[model samples]
Target: MKKLIFFLLLLLAGFNLMAQQDGGTYRAQLPEITMDSTSSLHIISPEPIRYVDISSHAVAGDLPEENVLRLKWVPDSTGNLSSGADNLGVVTVIGQTFIAQYQLLSAAATPGSKLAASYDILPQHIRPLHLPVEISTPQLRSHALSLLARRNPSAIRTAKQYGISAELNHVYTLGDLILLDITYHNSTNLGYDIDELRFKIEDKKITKATNVQSVEIRPIWQLYPIGSFKRSYRNIYVLKKATFPASKILSVELSEKQISGRTIILKIKYRDILEADNF
Candidate 1:
């Protein structure tokens, strides 16, 4: 009888140990959020939620601190806490326990005029993953601009000495579809083929206006002495019709290639149209 009793006690202890090892607990603490406000509710979990099994749902009963897992207010039909037309509330959980805080936008002076909020607790199992890499033009453009702006004049002179010349110019908009004349001079020894040139306009008030090409001209060079090789190249870029704001940034990039050392020049002119404001 003594042996049997001792065996039964040992079995009970083993069962209790197994039960404790198989179960886990959690608690959640949430902050408050108001309507029309950029606020975030913080959720704190006692134990890392990542350890929980993905197939199982973590409920309030599974939490170690069940008393703290109460909703701050009765939720409305849309699962939101509202005093009238405003939504101000949040729910957060730490481990297996959760706490919800509702923001009081208006006075709940009248009886039964309190905000109601409700939500279903969801089981979350997050997995770590890597994202694929992709190129972004805007990021590249910003980096390139920063690099160009910080370049020293010595670098520009070296490029000029290598028969490469770069120029920065702008087009000012006058009244009605009229543009002022623009000019670019290349003091390099090598001629470059204009690969591509782009223009960005900075204006906020201007409306849609068609880009018109007016004139493009290049100067010719008669073969003379080694020091007297004056050559010029020019063209007018006709832009598509487009509307623009009063404040904007116009960017133009030109590319070129040449065999013989020569300087290149460019001239551009255009017209912009605006709608007649009839107040």
Candidate 2:
């Protein structure tokens, strides 16, 4: 009876030791990233990883926001990667689980390439995950300029509508003297007084004033239709020349209010030459 009791106690001890070894918990190990443009590489541990809390480093300046850490597999020879994500500093394992996946991006390899990665582990907040990858130079060249131009169609339409027209006659430099030769015609049969003539340059409202000199005008026909009767007036206004450092755009807008109707015309011109240095 005593021997049997001792044997049963030893069996129970062995069972407890085995259970401690298989503690029902394990951490997924980081996998080696291999460079292969033909296939995507993935590392997955059974544990669920949360990406929202991961720390990320962004390149300085105005960069395209779309390319920010969206799972890109760059070639191994592309030098220092522009951006990467840092692991969330710590990972908790409830049970035995491990999973990870890396999707590749289509880009050619330059010299000195590397794979940028982010791994989330505990204690240290964010950690940079990097792995050496091998890549081969691509044989085919791609034309990206046409693709970029196609993406921005609105700019093309605006250029076509508001671009320089052939009606511009004078070539003026920045800070140069210029003269505005404006002509106004009274197209209505009944005599009407001109209230104001407003000139706007470069989208800026310049001046609005009445005619200071006295003027007389007579209608040729009783009631002038399109080409029936005629009345014309001309004014010379002096403008100080201005220079733009680079190629600048100048827009001229004319606003006239008469007894009959109000008319407005806008003209845009590009100035490439500099006329004056002093402001």
Candidate 3:
């Protein structure tokens, strides 16, 4: 009976030890960061900070910019916030695309006139939660403008409808994106009110009564914001780089607001996409 009681006690102790070890591994091992109560620490992120989890030992506030975070530590009267990891505070900064974690360590104040340290959260540091890669909107717009300046031969894929001419001027490849330069020439006096500008992949030939099967492609970005234009107008559109069968065709359809409801479609072939110039 005495031996059985001792064995039961030992089993309980083993379970308790395992539980503590599991708890320690629950939180990720974060990067260690050092700061002192005598100074301020600033952290900046490339994207806006959507959520922040901070410890109670420190006071944190956001600056005017949504991407910046300010942190300051407050110590006890003895000028010490224990050296143990349990007493230490942590900071977790989350963005739309990535997450960052830092373990704050209390350090002796450096000899200076109230020092301030800044840290930037770069793309290479964080784990991308949802996005595969970081994309810059401004860079895309700038590159699109540069492509528009290039000289290309007269367009072979074009269509005319009611005095309006739609032309697919050039196709360029940038990274995983396809940039297209489209120009609309209005010879008539009437300005064109654009109702819709759409892209799609459709069958090259349609039967008399068969249902038309088409897949619409949405542009990731476009250069212009105008609703109406006169004379000659040119714009750049961006789409994800893709491929289609030779029997399929890429179509750019432009429609005007109803009343006159003028419409034009510019068809591009798979061979044209294969010949896209690199930007």
Candidate 4:
């Protein structure tokens, strides 16, 4: 049941792309980003980047993947927004030179400053899953206990959708990743299992002025066993942090893993991101 999801959605290079949506004039707080192959976006500005709004277009550009490159915010490894994670950074995927435009609401860049981004393609390939020999079962249980004990929930941020309730536990931004802590609860009799789950986002609007095509966010993490009560786990283990378009109505859709038709939508407000960042 868990294996088929990788092939569920056709990774059509640039399918369902919205026409060039006007992102309006965006200011580059940091004049130049050291665009490299790695998925991290390096900005010189120290300001919080949650306010940065960006949209990517699938154009017939000079790159191999005309629709190959996509941008996402790199979430902290621990899913805690503040710990060793970046709330204000952008990361690109598929290592291609595509067109991405963004803007900051409160900051302005020096005149003639061009916003630049690049991805140096690495040896990207899907390898067989391997578990190291040094780890013991006792160690695994100890680690799980540590994750279960995480107690950071920003009292101000909380949301419930698809029978799942999430409270913003903790978030810290760093130079590399943004740490995030979230406690999830399933109110129904059905069990929560990633082997059969799916996550997607529809960009109804980016900020008050921008728009983007809908995208499927893949491979979420599960901390405890299925049907655990009020259990919280930072999804940093299996999921990479992502940058979402600063959309006004960011719809996070979750569907039953085994039964795709049974789904739920969480309308994440713009305030959700900002408030989490502020916390």
Candidate 3, residue 276: the lDDT equals 89
Between candidates 1 and 2, the lDDT winner: 1
C-alpha local distance difference test of each model: 0.32, 0.30, 0.78, 0.38
| Model 3 per-residue lDDT tens digits across residues 72-171 | 7654522545443333467888876788877776655444343438788866657767755535555777888887877868895888889999888988
Q: Which stretches of candidate 4 lie over 4 Å from their true place?
A: 1-148, 152-163, 193-201, 204-212, 217-245, 248-251, 259-261, 267-279
Model 2 misplaced stretches (Cα beyond 4 Å) = 1-175, 190-192, 203-230, 244-261, 266-268, 271-279
Instruction: Give the best candidate by TM-score.
Output: 3
Model 2's alpha-carbon lDDT is 0.30
Candidate 4, residues 1-279: lDDT per residue as tens digits?
A: 555654454433224333244434333432223222223333321111212233322111222222233343332322333322123343222211122332311111222233344433323211122332233233434444454576654443566766777554544332222334445567766666543233445665456565556666553333344333333323422233456656534444434456534454545544554444411
> Which stretches in model 3 have alpha-carbon errors above 4 Å?
1-131
**Candidate 2 lDDT, tens digit per residue, 1-279?**
999999999999999999888834222333322232333323222222323221122111121221122223334533443334322122221211222332223233422245434323222222323422111111000111122223222211111111111122222222233433333345455433444433333332334563223122221111111221135443333344443322224443332334344443434333322321121
Model 3, C-alpha of 206: deviation from truth (Å): 1.0
Error (Å) of candidate 4 at residue 261 is 5.3
Count residue pairs with overlapping backbones in model 1. 41
How does candidate 4 fare on TM-score? 0.32
For TM-score, candidate 2 versus 3, the one ahead is: 3
Displacement of residue 181 (Cα, Å) in model 2 is 2.0
Candidate structures ordered by TM-score, highest first? 3, 4, 2, 1
